[model samples]
Target chain A: LAKTTQPISMDSYEGQEVNITCSHNNIATNDYITWYQQFPSQGPRFIIQGYKTKVTNEVASLFIPADRKSSTLSLPRVSLSDTAVYYCLVGVPSNDYKLSFGAGTTVTVRA
Target chain B: SAVISQKPSRDICQRGTSLTIQCQVDSQVTMMFWYRQQPGQSLTLIATANQGSEATYESGFVIDKFPISRPNLTFSTLTVSNMSPEDSSIYLCSVEDGARGTQYFGPGTRLLVL
Candidate 1:
């Protein structure tokens, strides 16, 4: 299984920064690091994806170094609504590529 | 960006009854995926629904329990058979992100078993 490891849960204050890191030591060459944000009672939404270095979008930014051993998701100036679970997955589908899911990091942005 | 939708936003069904969740994509897609997420848990890929072929289920999922159908490129359905309390989850459908090899999910269907 191409698994990922991250903190079980995290806490932050409103207008603060939140950074979640995921470690995938056994990631493959073709694997792409993708992050998703999931709220209560809702599905996971695509946040960002990066192969290496930094990839930024309107929602968040993903930083992946050359080693590819780990990646970080940065959410700037978070609000209470920004509280959600974040998942880091490595790899893409070609022939039933399995997405091994762990208990994602629950980020709570408190007021 | 693509828009994906799922039917039956929320449902409460008695045990032993079945529920079929529908997923529709605004545009044609190359690959579709089904996922199950329990309360306070991360998303689990239930199966990979391919157009014109059988659904490829994950390790713990069985086709008999979670039947998936991808009749075409733009739509798919997942049926939870012989439902139990364990079947209660947020069922979601996703499409492949062509450029980044990512998966974009729908709003999802929330199912609660009684």
Candidate 2:
């Protein structure tokens, strides 16, 4: 498993764009970078996933560089409801039987 | 995304007791997983439930302490035996759709042991 490093917490104002970056220097070739958002008393929700380059969805966008050493999750116009812990995981698709989680970045979107 | 539900959303148990958390998925899934999240900490994978066979446990987690049962594709149960205050945490059940490498999770069962 590729260990990830991220900020312990981040603060963003409403209507502002917030970007959280994760470092996975030991990522493997078959690994895909996935991001999840977890709210209080709730399970982590899939926000975005990408193998390389940029992948955009209705909820968020994932940017991965060619080296695959790191990735960034960009949330445009964040709101108070977006306050939650965001986890970044790297795993081989077929071999992703278990996800090793680290202390996720807790993003607090304020007014 | 699948709709998953767990019984007894929250419970308080006495030490040496056991609690079995039930997980039900709205649709059949190929893989089901159990996780434990300690307060102020991240989630930890407990085991992977396999239908009709023994579950695969992770390091530091034994079947005797965390027994898992996947009776079918749509339901599974996790029994936390010999509970202690250290065992107090939120237990979550997740399902993999096998569609886009995404896993959906349940609301989670909050357990407090005294």
Candidate 3:
């Protein structure tokens, strides 16, 4: 499993764009970079996933470079309800049964 | 996408008593997972339940403490055997939809062993 490092917490104002970047120095070739959002007392929800380049979904966007050593999760027009911990994971699609979650980056959107 | 559900949303039990947590998915999935969440901490993988075979447990977990059963692809159960104070935590189950590679999770069973 590729080790991931991220910020412990971040503060953002409502309607402002927020970007959380994760660093995985030893990312593998086949690893897919994925991000998840978890609210209080709730299960983690998949936000965005990408192998390389950029992936934009209705919820968020994932930006990955050619090296694929790091990825950024961008949340546009953040709202108060967007306050949650975000997790970044690096792994292949199959046989990687374990979903290793780190401390995660807690993003708090203030009014 | 799959909708997952778990029984016994929350329970308080005495030590040495076992609690069986159930996980049900609306559709049949090839891979089902069980996880434990300690208070104020990240989630940990407990085991993977595969249909027609024994479940594969992660390191630091064993059948004696966390016995899991998967009779079919749509459902599974994890029994906390000989529970202790250290075993108190939230138990969750998840299943992946192959087409989108998205994993859906249940509401989770919160167990408090005293």
Residue-level lDDT of model 3, residues A12-111, one tens digit each, is: 9999999999999999987888898988877788888899999999999999988988999999999999999999988876644457888899999999
Task: For candidate 1, give the lDDT of residue B17.
Answer: 94
Kindly report which residue stretches of model 2 are placed more than 4 angstroms away from their true locations once superposed.
Answer: none
lDDT of 1 by residue, A42-81 (tens): 7777788888999999989899989999999999999999
Compared with the true structure, model 1 gives a TM-score of 0.91
Q: Considering only N, C-alpha and C atoms within 3 Å, which residue pairs clash in candidate 3?
A: none
In CAPRI terms, model 3 is classed as: medium
| lDDT per residue (tens digit) for residues B1-114 in model 1 | 889989989899999999999999999986899998887667788888889989888889998999888999999999998999988888988987776566778988989999
- Give the lowest summed-lDDT range of ten residues in model 3 chain B: B96-105
Strongest candidate by TM-score: 2
TM-score of 2: 0.98
lDDT of 2 by residue, A16-43 (tens): 9999999999999889998999999998
lDDT of each: 0.86, 0.93, 0.89
TM-score of each: 0.91, 0.98, 0.96
Query: What is the DockQ score, from 0 to 1, of model 2?
Result: 0.76
* Model 3 TM: 0.96
Tell me, by lDDT, which candidate is best. 2
